[model samples]
Target: MTNSKDLAREIVEGTGTEVEKGRGPSQASQITALARERYELFMSEDGRPYGVKVDGANIALPLRGKAGLRSQLARIYTDAHDGSVPAQSALTDAMVVLEGVAQAADPRQPHVRVARGDGVLVVDLGDADGQCIVIGPDGWRREQRSPVLFRRSGAMKPLPLPLRDGDGLAKLRALLNTDEDGFRLLVAWLVAAFIPDLPHPVLTFRGEQGTGKSYSAKMVIGLVDPSGAPKRTAPRDIKSWATQAFNSWALCLDNVSIIPDWLSDALCRAVTGDGIVDRALYTDDDVVVLEFRRVLAMTTIDAGALAGDLAERLLTIELHTIPDRARREEAELDAAYSDAHAGILASLFDLLADVLRVLPDVQLTERPRMADFARVLAAVDKVKGWDTLESYKATARDAVADVLDGEPFAQAVVALVDRAGPGGIVLTASELLERVPAPDRLPKKWPKDPTRAGGQLKRLAPALRTIGIDVDDSKRGPKPKKQRLYHLTASADRRCETASPASPYDPETDSDQQEEGGRYRGDASGPPATRGDAGNARGDAALFVASPQDTGPDQHGYSRGDAGDAGDAEMHPLSVPAPRTHRTPGQDAEDAPQDARPTTPCARCSRAQWNAEGSPLCLDCRTAA
Candidate 1:
């Protein structure tokens, strides 16, 4: 008799010849056909990974772990044949053939029990009946089965059956320990979570100890994705964090006390559309990708000063501690929430569908860091006749900061420039350090030496400019300009220190307290060519921005001025300035003429004082001369 190997090889190599030969169907064909009959295999939504659709189910089984698809197939064979399982050799041969089936399949974008389908929002109920809800311009209603393939994780729990008339939203809202503006933001975040393809903002809540931060987070997560584990402690590292991301649609870190550098970077990536990559196993070259644009939320008492990138992406909402008279037992709150859960979900769906109907007509003059999030919610605000976006912008604009509260280097730079007056100071890293040494209680991120100081300045230049401090690296000129120098001045609104164009802000005497931002937008009204890259650089400078490494010592870092050592600060800023023609760092009078760039005006020529109407002369110090 022929061995199973001979039959398997024949099956794989066969053409129409097998049928023409009119022989009995081979054992290999029978084994492979069982999988074909029981499952439908195809690529995932992004067209990079594969998943299996179990014959009569709404959920798609992932082709992830070593036995992800194989185990199910083994169970199927046993159940089909009177508790007699297939031989291990036969099962192995079948899986190899099934792999071929998967390779030849088409790509289908799988939804995580929530997706947009046929001009409506599709949310799988995750129930045993395979039911789902279709929400759109017409309204929301239940369907026998979801039209989209819902990718369910092992940890995913079913959503509450939505009640069209329930006051669930009001109940949930009353439970939140926030003000009206905060409530509006909370609702907006919930709506944005359901929308597809947009970059979602991180909905962060912080307050005193008894503010119900974790409880609020749990309630919010329940609205979209109700899981047995609603709130998780922040993961220790990026790898563990990525694992948490794969297991749920909504990721909530409860009462996080610290936002470490690695976690901060990862959260930013997740907020936007960046992927989380990890080793498939400890001993292999294989990888896993959780690249989906997911909904992110966090609760923190004080993560301390947030990183600039994180600040831009954060929709920070403050919660107040529950008054002793108002506080209720956890069991009471849970029982009431359970009663109202379905209605709240229904009301949210109703609002989202209405917003979707008018979403195309909504226009935002200013788009923030999470522009997509703004666009969708702006549409909601337009329909509701509310200024929810205005509230979001106000919060975001205030939070988009370069310097964390109490940062030594930035505070020192502010002081140094304040002392020198408007012209600012032109000096090297060491000189600047010598004159304006960091305070005794140096922050952890402060630079220890000149090398670190220069690096810190390079990173802080864009952020510093937000508060009206300009830093520039001057090019070597004639003999007088022997040392490469860094030119510091009160921001251009205050002086004619560097050769970049007039900044995009009020061209007048600014207030003493320079605000971090006036708007949460780039120049959306400006032409794309003129605006350049939509980077994190605050204000007009971001319109034409690049990465800090792209800027290097040549543009704004510590150059080897007068043969000094390199000094850089520890933490890089959230944004770097765009490349521009700066006054060749401390270029003397003649050097500017040779480069075809205008020379720096005399010390008296700055924004601090008015110049003579028709006179080329500017300095009040020189007016007497």
Candidate 2:
């Protein structure tokens, strides 16, 4: 009888016949060579082939060639037998066929096909055993490993996750379906999934807590690897997993609080065709350069935490909380999974494979903005068949609107001014600093002493001016003027007061009215008179010439008799005559007959009075003096 080695060698030679005849080695030849070597080594010292166990099934096979080949053959045989090779004799035949099948089914060669239906993909494995693995977008797998011959049933397609089974799953499905464009976008994502050199782009799921964000992510995970689900990772672990290069199918990072700058930079570089290296976890002395070709999706409460560069590359979806408890409960019921769900996912993978096979080639242009959006939408249309590319285009347009709208500095300055209130409409340099929200929140780099903050504020002056706010430095003295203050112009105030229906009536109006009226009316409660007015009156009084010895024009250029001088003299009137000496009753009448020295009039009484009672004046005179 011919030995197993002789049989294996004959098979190998037959497979290699084409290569020997000037044709290159066919995939069959390579597989036979590898398999034959393994079969020869499995022979025991007694010359009998050992039993190879694959997943509990046993196979008796001859091992040959390299030791590594023999070990691989044993594993492959065991895997074929569902982890264990049953009988040695049966193992040999099974090992040969499987090797042939694996070689023939090499996915590297273009043979996949796109199938119809939602979330469905069909991968055609030509001839040898004709096996197909059904998978979902979330990576879930079916328990039944059917033979390739089973593919003849019909073209496979992905089925939407059953939403009627459970509330949580239903909510997730509904959230995904809320935007019709999302389906097309998902299809596009699936198309990009097969490209090896593409960067590990991030998908952001943003929403409030308990709004089914996590559930939605889980559903995606289930679709991608039904057999082996993706592990939930922390933000810090992203670097570690990303360093593994293209090994992972997808990465789902949930609950990201603060995104580190390094991670953001790395992610941006990764998505933009700049591959990253992993120096932190290299096993060899030379650094390990890992290509992050995996698809990255993340969840966060606030999308703003992501870097602007990274944000541009992302496909963000906002999830809203389900309000009606009954509806939510009904959705949860629909999402409940059965064994059929896994089958649906498998069909979806086959559908995706088919789409990839028939997709039109797209050449992106220099217009990165439009190209990126187009690429995303195109992928969605090809994979999911959702027919919502236009809607996604709208979403892209919205994203662009947000990006190119205005500078963050302008917004910050406006916010500061708004908070400063009208009581202090003018913001002093120090007060401006105080009014500004934390420097960390602003986009501009802050200086140690907040000097840079002032510069940033200055840069926003033009924007403020556009909105009618003024930057005033007039209050500063002549040389080396102080920092300017920001004040809302009248127009600006009016705009503010009118902008809000609930704003109080203009407070400045009252103060303005009082000022305009008081200038001419002379407010009784105004500041006291100055020394300049007092000095002017004294100078004018000396120039006044009225009946007395004229003090003539003094240093001031004035004639003592000038009428203009009289007004000044009234302000500082001349002194009156002294009282006459009084006469005793028995004394000479000459002393009393002096007629009180011709009293012109008591300054206060305006009437002549006798000075008989000694040189005392009237009560009115005394009081006036």
Candidate 3:
């Protein structure tokens, strides 16, 4: 008689088919039964096979193909049977075949882990009971686990909670300041954090030292992670951003002096939920993971020149030092903070529920930055009977207005529009140059030459579009050259009609009629060429004898005297282009010497140097030198 162990050995050795002297046909049946009993294929509930494993510990290792399966089984054979080398080899091959047959018979076993991201709301409801709660823009419910990847990883320590009350609300309101637009923006940002996959705007806090930028950041961080601490240093670069994006739930860089270009690009990607591929730590293959679209905020004394696209994606919250500001530092506030946070959390849940309940019926005429958030606020109005949505819009509008006001070209546009008055005015390129005040007349950096001003106007079209201003080319009313018309309409109106090319700017026509006067002007010559370009010709023929101030680029990527941060290098339209090198009588194209260093004149002294070190200033002219 062939016992079960003997039959199993025979089957593993591939000798089950060969009948022994004492074994009958029944022994083959035993071998088949034992093979079926020894291995089973485990699968996930979602239908992913966890792969084949032995019956004992049932470990799922990455064993696929004949070579891999044989290798895996040879180890198992040695462990199970204490077999000799040749016997182990035969058993590995035999078990590989047997496991294949068994897997073919019954291929699936079940295992499951639940994870999901709602476009505007994500809550990690882990596989455990009584741990998390689920809320949405439409409704709310409590669950055992949280869906937030940052929260799930235990990166944050949530504060202990007590029953809610209205007492803490008043104090909290005073602390955050309900009247300030910055406070309102913070609330909107908090609401956005609960939203799942949408690109959330980066919240940048710019203020002088001791103005509570870091404190404000701590409050925001507490809302997201409850008891989390903000990382008080800037990330080194994009690679660091990539690594940190995966680790931190919400990144809050404090006192950032200069935002590197690469970090800005990475932040854009992180906001958009784009994936970044990096080489795995130990593996040769590249690991492509979803770029964590984590909530981002930063505190800076002076935010460096942000790329234009990045600027569009940022919500700047300017903090100021007040003489008699309310007293309560983070440490002093921590005593009441935990209970206050608990109340806020409870209120927040209630707010989310109300928003979701009325969301479908709420109507919004305009979508602004954080538009979806506005809709949520609209829902809050419908259900909570609060004027939250109106406040939200007002806050966002003012923030944008402030950004535009900071920009030199944008300010020039505003000045022109203000001059146009209630009915609006259309000015010809030449007329516009005559009417729009020069930098000396109004603010700074206004193009003095008509053609240079026209070029500035063209570059500023996108900025104008942001503020609901319209611009178009027209060849209206007996004009040989096309006139670029500025259509400044009531900001409440989003769309603007194109100006009539046939209707030229008439100091006589009503501003309302200007739109109807212009016929479509297609493919006409742009503003006439002027000496130098918009950059150098900014002082073409100064309207006044204004002395130019020499202020170097400060930490904010602007001259020290500027009201705010300068536009990014890529977005800075007025930066002078490199001077053209014209051949002299004795000069040839080949005569130009090639050198590793820049041939342009030094920024400081404006003198050309043959051996200038890589600095923007010549060696002697450099500040450090």
| lDDT of every model, 2 decimals | 0.66, 0.43, 0.50
TM-score of candidate 1 on Cα atoms, chains taken together: 0.71
Better of 1 and 2 by TM-score: 1
Q: In model 3, state the lDDT of residue 177.
A: 34
The residue ranges of model 1 lying beyond 4 angstroms of the native Cα positions read 1-31, 45-51, 66-68, 85-93, 279-286, 398-403, 415-435, 449-455, 458-625
Cα-lDDT of candidate 1: 0.66
For residues 1-625, write the lDDT of model 1, one tens digit per residue.
Answer: 5566765666664321344466754434555676677678776644334445554656676554445566676676678667876666666666666666776887777777678887888888888677899988878899987877777777678998888765656877888889988898888889888876677888888889988888888888888788888898878887778767766778788887667779888888877666776666564886656666678888887634666667767787899878899999999989878888888888898888888888888878876657878888798788778778888877775555422443667777776665444446566777667767666787788788887888878876755665567788764323864655677777555433222222222324422211122211122223333433222223433343344444445545531111011221222333332333335677754444422333222332222332333343344545676
**Per-residue C-alpha lDDT of model 2 across residues 1-625, encoded as one tens digit per residue:** 5566755765655443333346543334444444544432233322222333233211232232223234555556567546763344333444455444443431221111221223433332222333344434444233232221111111222333322232332333443633545543554554455343344346666778766676666556445432133435454655564543233445576787667767777666656544445543334653433443346677778665554455556666666665656235535533554333544344444444555444455344433333544554455455556654555445543433343234454454555444333322454456555645555555434333446555655654543543445555355422565655545333435345433231122334422111111111012122323212211234435664445555445524532222123344334334321332444667654454443233322212223332224433444556555
lDDT, candidate 3, at 307:
43
TM-score of each: 0.71, 0.41, 0.51
Rank the candidate models, highest TM-score first: 1, 3, 2
- Candidate that would win on TM-score: 1
Candidate 2 Cα misplacement greater than 4 A, ranges: 1-36, 39-177, 181-184, 187-201, 226-231, 235-239, 243-245, 272-287, 327-373, 376-390, 393-625
State residue 561's C-alpha deviation in candidate 1, in Å.
43
Per-residue error (Å), model 2, residue 64 = 22
Q: Deviation in angstroms for 392 in model 3?
A: 3.5
Lowest-lDDT window of 10 residues in candidate 3? 516-525
lDDT of 3 by residue, 29-130 (tens): 333344455545433222222333343322332223344334555555456545623344454445445545644544432211112346335343222231
RMSD of 2: 25.7
lDDT of 3: 0.50
Q: After superposition, how far is residue 558 of candidate 1 from its true place, in Å?
A: 49
